[model samples]
Target: MVLLYDWSDKHKEGVTLMNSPVHASDLPDNQFDIGIVGAGMVGSALACGLARANYRVVVFDRQRPPPFDPQSQPGIRVSALSLASQKMLADYGAWQYIEAMRRCPYRRLAVWEKSAPRLPLPKLGGHRGTLFNCKDIHTPELGSIVENNLTHLALHKAMESLPGITSMCPANLEDLNFSPDTATLTLTQHPPVTMKLVIGADGALSQVRKWANIDFSSDQYEQQAMVITVEYAGKQQDITWQEFTPTGPLAFLPLPDVAGKHYASLVWYNTADNIDRLMKLGESQLIGQIWQHYPDCLPAVTGIVDRGRFPLIKRHAQTYFSKRAVLVGDAAHTINPLAGQGVNLGFQDVMALVAILSRDGKPLADPGEAVHLRRYESERRPLNGQMMLAMDLFYHAFSNNHTPLKLLRYLGLNLADKLPFAKQQVLQYATGIKSPPRWLFR
Candidate 1:
């Protein structure tokens, strides 16, 4: 249970625990209107939230969502959701479904200099100043690990009964014509439709942003991330780990599964050349490399189910909001996936935008107007910028193997640990529960 503060109620404004509503009808088109592109998690969740505010919503996607089949595939398509995001999903009625199928409740996360040598080998593996425990903050769980598909499915399920929300999947976006008055989306099959606003949740390669003449700036990282699911020989843990190497960062995120049978989602980030070599290696050879370098946390690799690679890229639209169109999620910005904040940031965008438009003071019919989308941009930009800067700093800091620099990086981690409040602040910021940008506080 959580308490929601009402900025208005003076008599009993101190604290009031709130229960999330179940299913709600879709908002009527002429009443509260909006259209979201991309039926992914971010788009679907926003649709549900907007519908709950009594806003008519429409969503478009090119592909149909696969059924949530746990046995068929049991790995996160590589993503970690923050606690704040989890709460938002729960409020949107997505948590129950996702938690049931693919949530790994992680209570503790440890990060340290694995390359550092100690007097004794055990001491080297000892808990250094870089550990985060949820119990310390009186929280039941630090964060929940979720699969991208599961989250989307859960959101789709929530939007089922929403009256004003229409989801058109397997539909192609042929054209986007936006003006000061209305945003019209021309579909290949369906009749040309118009809405007050058109969202660009399409992805890194956003068609809506392109059609709307929204320029974007981006750079591809020299390194590529290799993500795979492996069966580990250990207990199911609530720990997320990252080891900074000369090439890049490697991570092991725990997955929820049967007791004693452990599973992990592994991300091996390295230069493109090395990644090419690793990809050529058979599954056994790749697992061997993981075991060799990852000594302490090395889990015996029993199986290799799914494997994929994604070239890291950073992109941000030249403008976030214009006349009758706006961008969100990857279409707006995409940063290094090292910290796993990409999707979390997108979720924040949805929550903040929804909160502002759903407020009583906003215009009802054309909430997607310049004034409204501008408000959304003002609220999201600074926060997104801060996160992007942080990623750049971390990326550059760990990308080098200079002896002095490594020591300095270790010192910084140690200092972060010694300062309790500092550590908590970092945790709070990274996890997206608090320390939201000033505009979002409204």
Candidate 2:
């Protein structure tokens, strides 16, 4: 299903359909119900859901990721996708492609304190670590570690033949105009497009958000994440671990085995200064540093495959919608990566928004109406806020040298490990199946 559209003429305002043409005569030739300003995972997911529900949708992005290969070495950038998110992708028809391409499923997730050496667990007769295993809940696995590009590639593939989905790649968002009932997008590569709703899934610095005059609260996190891919010698393991340090949490997320060797992705969260110094070192030297600082539970790294780094920040749109427009994913909120919940949160937003818009089994009437969009905001805002705050609390509690905080966290972890119900609740939150206890918030 290689559907094609031509942008061969730079001056042309209309795209020429090449292969099997769409039934454009049924609807207005140029107008769309929704126009999404970014084709990243969130934007693409929303497009899939809406188009599958029979809503006209257009997704715009500067570029598309290359097709992923199951045999290729995994990238340093990866996400810990939750179980709830997996079902969403399955519904969107992307999960099958993703499964065929590559993914690493982990049955257990472990979190521990890096400074626990000072207070030996045996001496205190307490737990050595806190762990959540999928088997406890009768689930096959907690989730999967998927390469960022592979997920994007899967979404793009799923969207290729979906009815009412328009691909606007290699196109630039020139400007946006909003009337009382409509929004018009001006793109550099194509003509003007008028839509009832202009969805801003364009990420944190969303131009559509600014154009809609949506205010946002953004704070710079003190830590930067250093990500690296490693090739190791061993069987493919099925456990993900995060060890908290005064700087930040150092995590090891496994990758599927290729050939006879195994692989894993590492994320070292630390202050900007430390990350800068670490990045300046040679690969061998940096690997040596990682081996020294990271927990011994990590698999032996035979070679460093790749490395990258990015600064962390917390961002939340003051509101999710404005005149004839709405924001989703990183455009609405970006949380700390300590729990690897960023993408899952975005997928959750899409699911909520789709549920609100598609309840009628047809394209929404007056799609940009405040009444309709506000429902989405009301449903998602609190949950996203709770997760954001929860991550912040975890960050401060674990990423410090304070004795009292350390001891408190240790005792809490030991207790949590000993209590079956408490551990299940935490897993539910982490896996996006349920929210934290209501008592915590009250």
Candidate 3:
């Protein structure tokens, strides 16, 4: 069942909804209020969120998403869910479905430089790295770790009963036409559908972004991420941590135990050459590497379940909107995965866009009006830019063996550990619960 809040009407609102396809002939002149291209987590969430607000939403995806299975081995593609994202999912009724499946909640986060933990320098703060505990901040958990496919499937299921949404899977976008009042989308399966707005929630290589003529800047790093899933037997942990080595950061993300077996998702970021060599290693050899390099808190890799590799890249559209369309998620920006903030940033974008479009609960003169789209762009661009820059700084400082930079970063991290209030603010920003200081964006 689906419930809605009527913004135009000042009173509390509740309404049950059903999902059905709105054919091209069902609407006046075959026009939908909104046409979203991409049914991944970001796109599906936007469709549901907008549909709940009474907007006629249409979503298209090239392939149908596979069903999420709890009985299967963990997938290599997973995401770190922040507190703000968790609240959004719960509000949108997606969290229950995700929680009903397999998920892991982590309460603590620790980050440290690999070589500086033992250096005793009082003038430069303590030797150990900074640790942020949820208990210290009065929260039950910092975030949850979930499989990427599961998140997409959960959001897709949530859209089932949303009244104003229509979706076509195994449908690919062929072309797009933009005008002042409406955008026309030509798809492979259905007749061309016209709509007031088009959303590009597609992945890094966004066709919607390309067709919209929205210029973008992309940065490809020399580093690559090697991901692996492993089964283990040990005491369960509620904390996730990353240790910065000369190559890159090697991190452990906790996963829920199944049938008395503990599991975790491992992320090893390093140069493409090194990642290639590591990827070629057999299960036992890779386990040996992990056991030798990782911190003592993690469990031994008893068995390997899955492995994958991806290159690191940073990209941001020069403009988020063009004519009657706007971009969302990786279409608008892609950041380094050093902190796993990519998807969380995308979810935050949906939140901000929904807030602007649903202002006063009254329908806008035109949902895709330049003014409204610009408003969404104005607020999100600077914030994403700030995070991108910060991550870049971390990458350069830690990836290199430069003596001065390594020392500076270690000292700064150690100092942050000592400063409670400041560290809290940083944690809040990192977890998407709050914005960073405005000056940082500037």
Candidate 4:
């Protein structure tokens, strides 16, 4: 289904493929019990969750779905979904569609020292250290790599089958008013509506958040990230590799074959100035630079399909909930993408908010009491806080080229590799199983 969005005017031009007109009369006075801003993965998932709980729901977004053309422009960004996260999407009835769309599962993951040669396995009588694989966890695959667009599409499709869901695309809030007991939004394109709760699932630059007067603290990272899609001519094994480098951590995330060609998503991290210089480089020149950095074990350069760069910033709102309004996903926090935990963090937020608002066979209406919102905030803030701190420490330690830090990194990786128990523990943490502060679910 093609859902072309025409944003010619700030108001009155938004419509979906079904050609259903959205206007003030479409909404009943005090009709929908909940309103969600933002239609990204988190927002869409939350909308489905609430609808399943039997709450009247509406979703507001600026972008509309493009046709599902194979030759369509590929999305510039992607996300890594953990094992538990994949299950959550399945429960929401999107796994089948997402699996058929753009998911690439990795059966094994391999991490090695970047600058140095592959270390020889330690000898056990006549044999060396054993190689570890995903089978250690009793599963054949570690996780799946999904394009941002595909995930959204699958969720959006599932949402269509659900009752009590009304999607408003290419719409923005022209006016908003909130109080301790009730919240109201006046969409410029449609009639005004009031609800018991308003959720900010919009994104980092959330309009809902701005209208609610929620302040956020942000930190700017000196580094920038470049995303590239490359063709590797080597074996098409199901494995993902991460190599810590002087500039930053380099990751190769696998993709399913396209007519027998092997493809991977690359994340190249470096200083902002250096990234700017490369952004201006021609396609051939950019490929040459990548070859210079990753010479060995890299497949022949089939092509660099798409490349883009962006400055890295970490943001967290001062509070997750205020009055009758609440924030979730990038609306609440933004973290480093190095560990591929950004989406995972958002999934946890959805879980916590849904648990508080919909569980125990309670009313699907207004879960907006101060005490209830406080419970949501308390569960997510510390968890996200700890993740931000961990990412900062790893970024500083591995990206720095200081003499002392070099020795410390080498010692750390070597020790972790030697100790079987430590290695397994680290694996569990990376796989989102066990951690200092575990996720709200599992």
Segments in model 4 whose C-alpha atoms lie over 4 Å from true places:
1-30, 71-74, 116-132, 361-365, 434-442
lDDT of each: 0.75, 0.84, 0.83, 0.76
TM-score of each: 0.87, 0.92, 0.92, 0.88
- On TM-score, who's better, 1 or 4? 4
> lDDT of candidate 3 vs native?
0.83
The clash tally of candidate 3 reads 1
**Residues 342-430, model 2: lDDT tens digits:** 99999999988888888666777777888989999988888888889989898888877887787789887777788898888878877
Query: Model 1: residues >4 Å from true position, as ranges?
Result: 1-32, 117-129, 258-260, 361-363, 436-442
Q: Give the TM-score of candidate 4.
A: 0.88
Clashes of 4: 0
Q: What is the lDDT of residue 420 in candidate 4?
A: 74
lDDT of 4 by residue, 227-321 (tens): 88877687875777777888887778887666677778888889988888888888899889988886365667677878889778999999998
Best by lDDT: 2
Model 2: weakest 10-residue lDDT segment is 2-11
Each prediction's RMSD over C-alphas, in Å, is 10.1, 4.0, 6.8, 4.4
